[model samples]
Target: MASKLIHAIYKDDDLVLQAVKQIRDARYHIGEVYTPFPVHGIDKAMGLAPTRLAICSFLYGITGLTVAVLMMNFMMIQDWPQDIGGKPSFHFYQNMPTFVPIMFELTVFFAAHLMVITFYMRSKLWPFRKAENPDPRTTDDHFLIEVDASDHNVDKLTDFLYNTGAAEIKLIEN
Candidate 1:
């Protein structure tokens, strides 16, 4: 049988938290949540694990450092060695100060560019991908709660939603 997704839309974050608290306290399964703006502590309340973005960020930073080192080394030592001042020679590691700017720029460059790419990939945002939104209004001013229930508990779910302060209730299929 195909699964059904029931979404209860709310306008306020506090109501969402309260409804989530009720469902969590009663041991109900929440499929997911959608919010326009991030509500602090919602993830914790939903028992979500911490993300590994930090690790990805570190790896991206290392990629930047590697690019910077290799590029500077190639230009100064291997490819085109140019003498800026007579006091120093055109050696890369020997003239470490000259590579500082490249290093800094690469670090920032890799972090920002790669971080965005990683985020988009992880979110499955690519060309021609079907959107996952149940309600278009959710992207602007609504918060959503998705619950899984069969015909047996649909009424109960809707009642709970109405009693819990949902602005609107709708059943969606995915």
Candidate 2:
């Protein structure tokens, strides 16, 4: 079955935000929204759930810290003991101060890299991936609101979108 959708393009981000609020208030099902840059509070306006990426970042940082500690312990104390700067490598705790900088750096490195990779994978934006935006202008200067129109009146939706300050409206079927 073919599903009908209405693409509402707004020139300004503020207008798009207002249109989204109006559309949701009118009980219309919004399929998606595309924007060139981040629109603050858009997720809340769209009634989307909060993200859990911060939790993942924390876990990744902990893992990196653990790995750094173990690696330093094994290399400095267990594998081959070293005496540098008159500091004994007999105990990890005794020489822990010197490894603090390495541990902190590794923790930040792992969290940042893993968070970026996770964001890319979650958004399905891997290298060589085809673009899924319905309008090319959305990547430049337009913000698009995709409304589900399968069971709604097309003319009414068009009127509502037009009234809500849409610069352009396009009907798409899939």
lDDT of 1 by residue, 1-174 (tens): 877878899999999988888877767788899998898888888888999988999999999999999988887778877777853545666888877988988998998899999998998898798988878888999999998875438888789888889999988765
Candidate 1 differs from the real structure by a C-alpha RMSD in angstroms, to one decimal, of 2.1
TM-score, model 2 to reference: 0.97
**TM-scores for the candidates:** 0.87, 0.97
How good is model 1 by TM-score?
0.87
**Candidate 2 lDDT, tens digit per residue, 1-25?**
8999999999999999999999999
Pick the lDDT winner: 2
Q: What's the C-alpha lDDT at position 110 in model 2?
A: 93
- Candidate 1: worst-modelled 10 consecutive residues by lDDT: 84-93
Indicate the residue-level lDDT of 68 in model 2: 96
Q: Tell me the lDDT of model 2 at 94.
A: 97
